[model samples]
Structure formats: C-alpha cells, structure tokens
Target: MVSYEGINNARPKTWATAADEWHALAKYSLDAAKDLREYGAKPLKDNWTDEVGATAAAEFAKLADQLEAAYDILLSVNMVADGMTTTIETAHSTMRAAVDLATQYGLEIGVDGTVTGPPPRSRTEAEEMGPYRAQVQDLVDQAVEQVTAADRLAAAEFAELAGQTGLTDPGKALNDLQTHASHVQMQMLANDIPVDEDPTTVRQWWNGLTDRQRKDMMLAQPVALANLDGIPADVRRELRGNGKYDRVKVVEYALANWDKGDPTDFGNNCTNFVSNALLHAGMKEKTSIWGTSDDDSWMIGNRTGVDGVDKRLAYSDSWAAAENNQNFMLEHGGSEVPRSDVKPGDII
Candidate 1:
C-alpha cells in the first residue's frame, strides 16, 4: 500500500559529497606517490640504506592500499545508487501499467496479487489466480535482482582495482580511471540518468559516447597531445564540421589579403573578430568575450598585462614607430574596419 508520492520521493542513499571526498583522498594519495618517487630519486651519495628505503616504500604501499579501498567503496556506493534509481524507474513503470490494467478491467490487484475480498479456499480457486500472482511476483523479483546485481558489481570492481594498485602505478592508473568515471558520470547526468556506484556501469557508460564527443572530451587524450602537429579529429570536426579542408586555399587567401601595417587589423583582428563571432554564436553576455575596451575591457580587474585599449594603442604606436610611418598610412586607409568585412588577416 505504498503511496505514489512516497515512491516518487524515494532517492538513492549514495551521497555525492562522499564521492567528492573519496576523489580528494585519491588526489592526496597521488601526491603521496609523487613524494615517494622524489624521495627515492635522491642522489646515491646520500647513502640511503635498504632498510630505510624499504620502510618508506612500505608506508607508501599502505597509503596506496587505503586509497584503493576508498576508491572501491566509492564505486560500490555509486552502483547502489544507480541500482536504486533503476529500480525506482522500473517500479514506477510497473505500477503505472498495473493501474492502467486495473482501470481497464475494473479490478484492484495488490503488488503481490492477493485478492482482498474472499480468500480462495480451494486449490482450484488458487490455481485460477496463479497467472496474475506470478506476473506481479516476477516484476518484483526482477527489480530486486537488478538492485542486487548493481551492488555486487560495484563491490567486485572495487576489489579488482584495489588488487591491481600494488602492481601498477596506482596514482596514474586510478587518476585515469577517475577521469573515465567522471566522463561517464557527465554523460549520465546529461541524459538525466543517475550515475550508479558500480564501476562496471561507469565503465560501460564511458565506452558509449559518440565518437566525436568522446574525441572532444579532454579525458580521452593525454595532455601531451595539446602541442601536436595536427589538430585532433574532434577539434577539426568542431571547427570545420566535416574533415575536408583546403589548407592551400586558406593559406592563399590569408597571404593574398594580409594587411602587414595595420596593428588593430593584423593579428589582433582575429582575436577581436573571434570574440564578436563567439558572441553571435549564441554565447551570452557572461560567456561572450567581446566588446569595446570599456564594455569588454580585458584589463578591468587584472593588470597582469597593460590595460585593454591602452595596450592595443601602445602596440599600435610602437609598431608605427618601428615601421617608420607605414602603420599610420594603413590605419588611415581602409585596412581597419568592422569584424564582418575583415577577412582572416584584417585588423580590428
């Protein structure tokens, strides 16, 4: 006789704060690993004995073990939460179906399908109610199994990760796994699905992103790839929509229309144009990074560099002095204009 409101109010027991705590702990453990590595790397002339190094190693190992345990617990909690969410969803659907059937047939059925009025005394009568009773029981059983499996899977993944910690670079491996988990959690959140505590489910979610999204996600590649020669496929897709790009055509266009003397229209032109373009591309006032020096002054709060308009003006003056009047001629001419009319190399 559970009320719909009560069922609707039900939530997973796992706390996001707890997950954050575990993640923090993992980060600390990673720092400890780095400390251990630095300690071990000290000059041989320091004359470190086997016993001392062994003791330090043992302590680090113990910390790693504790970290692994915490990670496992985190995964388990997430799995249970996921299971609870799934169970609730299934139960709601089942209840809705049952209510619909009852409305259609004009009969009330208990969750266990026991008739309220007139208990069936004879075996023949009980036999007649078997199908309905079985159907309800099956639904309940399925829900229970799913929840239980989620709990078990979470526990298993935690144990496996813990066992591997000692043999592998625990910090690096776990951090990678954590990144993967975060991506999975993001996807689940995006879809309005609850992230389960189970590592398996998290892993599955990580493996399920669209190829483009997956490539674009920072977690998918190492930071070292940032300065690589070619752009990532995901980045190219985002920039050009399709992969077909005429590099020669783009280069030729830029060179043919390049304005060498104008300071505002040269390199600064791209930044100004991009800033405005980004605003027009649906970025709001907060997100948009463009405007005049007063409206969008990049130097409003921070003075790490010179103030915005002043900085540009200073540069223009310096360039004009360096180029011996060539800059002023271009500035007075049609080189500088609004962003829309400017090509790739036009000054702002």
Candidate 2:
C-alpha cells in the first residue's frame, strides 16, 4: 500500500503567501517614492532653484517606475506559481482517486506505477479478477499520465514565460520544453492502436471481452478504441452499436446548426456535433457503445445542465473531441480517405 498523503502539494500554499508580501513591498516602494516627490522634492523645487533638487526629483521618478515594473514581474510570478500549484494539486487528486480505486479492487501500485495484485491461487479467482485487473491497471496508467501531463504543461508554460522575459537563455529553455512536449507526443503515438493490425487478431481480443466488460469499458474508456487493436473492421464499423446511418443527414444537420453548439460552454464540440449528426442521420443509440450521459459509451446530451435555468443545448467532450470521434468513426465502418476523394457529405 502506498501512502499518497504527501507526494507533492506544489510547495504548499507558502509561496502564495510570500507572493503577497512581495506585492506589499512593491506597493510600499511606490508609496515611498510618492511621498518623497510630494513632501520632499516638490517643496524643494517650489522654494529653492537648484540642480541637486531637480536631480533628486528625477531620481524619485525613476524609483517609482522601477517599483511599478517590479510589481508587474511579481504579479506574473504569483500567477505562474498559482497556476502550477493548481495543476499539480489537480494531478494529485486524480492520482489519489486512481490509487483508491485500485486498492478497492485488491490491486496494488508498485513504486514504478505499475499495478499488481494479491496472488490468485485458483483459476476461478484469476478469471474473476481479469477484467478488474485491467480496469485498475488502466486507472493507474491514467494517474501516471495525468501527473506527466501536468508537469509538461507547467514546464512548457514556465519556459514560455522565461523566454518572453529573458530570465533564462530562451533557446535552452525552449529546447527543454520541446523535449518534454515531444516525449508526450511520442508516448501518445506509441500507444495508439494501429488500425492496420490484422482483423483476425483484433477480433480475438474483442471477443475475449465479457459482454458487461465491453459495455462498461466502452462507456468508461472510449480511448480504448484508439489504443486497443484487434476487432474486425465490420465490427468496428458498427461502432459497437447497431444502427442505420445516413451520412447525408449528418452533413445536413451539421450545416443547419453550424453555429449552434456553444464553444464557450464546452470544449470544442466538433466531434460531438459529428456524433449528433450521425444520430440525426439515424444512428441508433446503443448502451454498449452509445449513450448520452457524461460517461456513456457515446453521446452528447441534448442540453446543458443548469439549475433553475432553462435547458441549453449541450454535448459531451468525448462525443465532440476529434480523437474520440475518429475512433468512433473508425470502429463504426469509417476509414480515412484522400482529401481529393472526399465527397461533400463524407466525414473526414
């Protein structure tokens, strides 16, 4: 068992407090300059004509400018620190939740972030734990990914800021950020379930999934479609759901509601719009590979959820995001075609 209590809190809230103090110091510097000009320099200028007084007043003005610049930098620092803290904390929360779920299912996470379990002595026990083990493993993997993503995002943002402010060698900082970004990109590329794998191999794996496991995972992890290979092309074509589809209607509905989905309300809903278009084109919603709930296999709800407010049209990120949409299309009898070959109603 791992004690997830204090892996990292992004240096606690102490940094934020320190930032407040720096802000106050900046203000004090500005106020002091103001007082020197008002009660000291201005009075000297009014009463006595001297180069020394003029120089002192000019210096006070310079001091005030420096103070304001310092304030701006300190504020930027505070914002960056706060943002990174929030990101790391969110990662910690997600990691903790994953660990808890794994533990609940009798799984243990090794220090390396791999998942293990209580040794199963019997065939029945092994069989029963199979699906659960996969789920726990998935959760652990996700937790690791969340942490990595948080680190990369923070690092990249910091590098950008540093480069902009010339605080560090911009080239070096940007190179480091690029390395981190590339690593993430490569990880994702390596994990992608190649669509070109043999249909037979894909089918065997798909067939091995228990019916309930299939439904649960499809709803819970649509990304699996993008990462797991070995389902017959025809099966993937059905989108794990049974339905008739009219690509023309899909296109028509999309054109009709071109600006309807609120981009501000949800993350870009292009995929969600495509999914709805398929539905409008007459693809039936199936629980196994289709649904409208936040965690359903595939769906964007008809309306946004707002308390005491009239319902507004809404959609799910999975249904609307490109990657998931591409997975859905590939699994459900769609394939990539050449740009020149595409017809007006065809989905890209």
Candidate 3:
C-alpha cells in the first residue's frame, strides 16, 4: 500500500551531504588522473623516445580518459540524485503542512485511507465550518495526488537510470535520460488521459498551467484535442468550436429569454428559446409547413390575422414545445448523441 510515512521521515539533508562528498570525490579523482597523465606519464614517455615507452604512455593516457569519463558520469548521477532528494524533501514539507492543517480540524486518516473526525460540537458550528471543511478536503486531495505522482516519478526514474546506463560515458547517460523522458511524454499524450480525469479536475489543472506549458502540451499531445470524458464540454467547445455561430451569444440569449413567452405559446417558451438560439446561430427559415404558423419550420413569431394579412410571425404549438423541438432536431441535420459522447455546441 502507498504511504506518506517515508516523506515524513526523510532525512534529505543527510543524503544531500553524502551526494556532495561523492560528487567532489569524483571530480577530484578525474582531475588527479588528468594531472598524472599530463605531468608524469606524458613527460616520461616523451623523454624516453623508445617504442615500448611510447606504447605504455599511450595506454596510460587511454586509461586516464576512461577514468575521467567514468568520474564524470558518477558526478552527473550523484547531482541528479541529490536534486531529486531535495525536491522530494520540499514536497514532504508541503504535505506535512497539509497534515498539520488537517490535525487542527481534528481529522485523522486510517490506513485504509478513510478520514475520521472529531465531530463538530453543534450543528451551528458544523454549518459554519462546512464550506471551510470542503476547501480543506480539496486541498488534502490535491496534496495526496501530488505525493503519489512524486513517488511514481522518483521510483521510475531511478529504475530507468539503473537499467539504461553505466558510468563509462556521462554524455550517453544524459542523452538516454532525455530520450526516455521524451518518449514517455509522447506516450502520455497519445493515451486516453482525459477520459480518466474528472472534467472539472482536468479543466482546473489546465487552467493552472503556464501559457507556454499549455501550448507545448497542445502541440505535443493533439489527441487531447478530442473532448474526452475528463474535460468539461463547455471548455472543449471554447477551445475547438467552429466560428459559424456565436455559441456564447446564443447560449446567453437562451438563458436570458427562457422565461419570456411568444405569441404562439404564451405559457411555454422552451421551443422559443431553442428557436431563438438556432436563429442567432444563423439558421434560416424553411418553407413547406416550416414557419411559425406552419408545422415544421424552427421559427417563433406571431399568430393572429389582420384583415388581409396573416400574422405569420407568431409561433405554433408544434414548434414552441420541448417535445416538438426534440423531434425537430431529430428530423433535421442532427442526431441523438449519448451523454458520454456529447461535446460542446451539441443540442441536447
């Protein structure tokens, strides 16, 4: 089972000190080897002017180069491990702060991941603390998620590092790490991540990212361009909607006018709102029983006749009710979509 006890008990400073010593030793050793090759081996070989001496010097120089390279790789690995330790230590402190806040609220988490509480003394206090408790709960949830991510990252990186490289070449180690990171990023981009994330949660996370990061992800992970289950439909619509209609304008109009009635249906305004939205979206009036007075057109206007003129601007009952609107959409250029498959700008 996953636990935060390691974070709570981490002695990162101690590990950091060890890393520093190791890094210094590696660098010092590399410098010493270089010095020995340049000052002792090379000079001695040059003064000898013998084939055996030259061959021995050349071999010593090759050994020195390998030694330097090995030390360089060692230092690189030590530096990375040191940085990771420090970062995780900081993360641990942050999580501890969250736990402190939870303690202040008399909250206790069981091993099974259930939270128990010192119940509020009274209903009034409970009521007052409800919103605050909700906020705290969200904070704790986010903290837990971040901790889990950190654990996974640290473990996976170390495992990959161990398997992929030896200290023979520092540059190769660095290159392999970068290549692996890029491959993992691409895999994440193509995966159905949004389908797994909560729509509100994903939207909030997206909003929190920097603009450059957002652009980078969008370019790198185009698969997320599809409105998945985890992203809010409205958010998707804003990002990917066609410019043929001002969706915001129409939706706002519907919200503002849903209570208002029309001449045809003075008591009901469902279809009127839908029709108004369609009109604002640039849908044109149709002929052949497709008007306010006709049986088909998605219109809303008038109904009475004035002398020789018919008040054709009114809406008909068949075009002003919810069921009628539903049928109209079904018969038109629209199809019924399941809630899971629905995106923004789609008619319900």
TM-score for candidate 3, residues paired by index: 0.43
Arranged by TM-score with the best first, the candidates are: 3, 2, 1
lDDT per residue (tens digit) for residues 179-220 in model 2? 443344333322222234444423433444446434433433
Candidate 3 steric clashes: 6
State the local distance difference test value for candidate 3.
0.55
lDDT by residue (87-115, candidate 3, tens digit) is 44534444554455557776765543345
The 10-residue segment with the lowest total lDDT in model 2: 307-316
The most accurate candidate by lDDT is: 3
Give candidate 1's error at residue 76 in angstroms. 5.7
- Itemize residue pairs with steric clashes in candidate 3: 199-230, 290-297, 301-313, 301-314, 302-313, 302-314
The C-alpha RMSD of each candidate to the native structure, in angstroms, is 18.1, 17.7, 21.5
Give lDDT: candidate 3, residue 336.
84
Per-residue accuracy of model 1 over 37-83 as CA lDDT, tens digit each: 55643432145548776676666555655555455434533533343
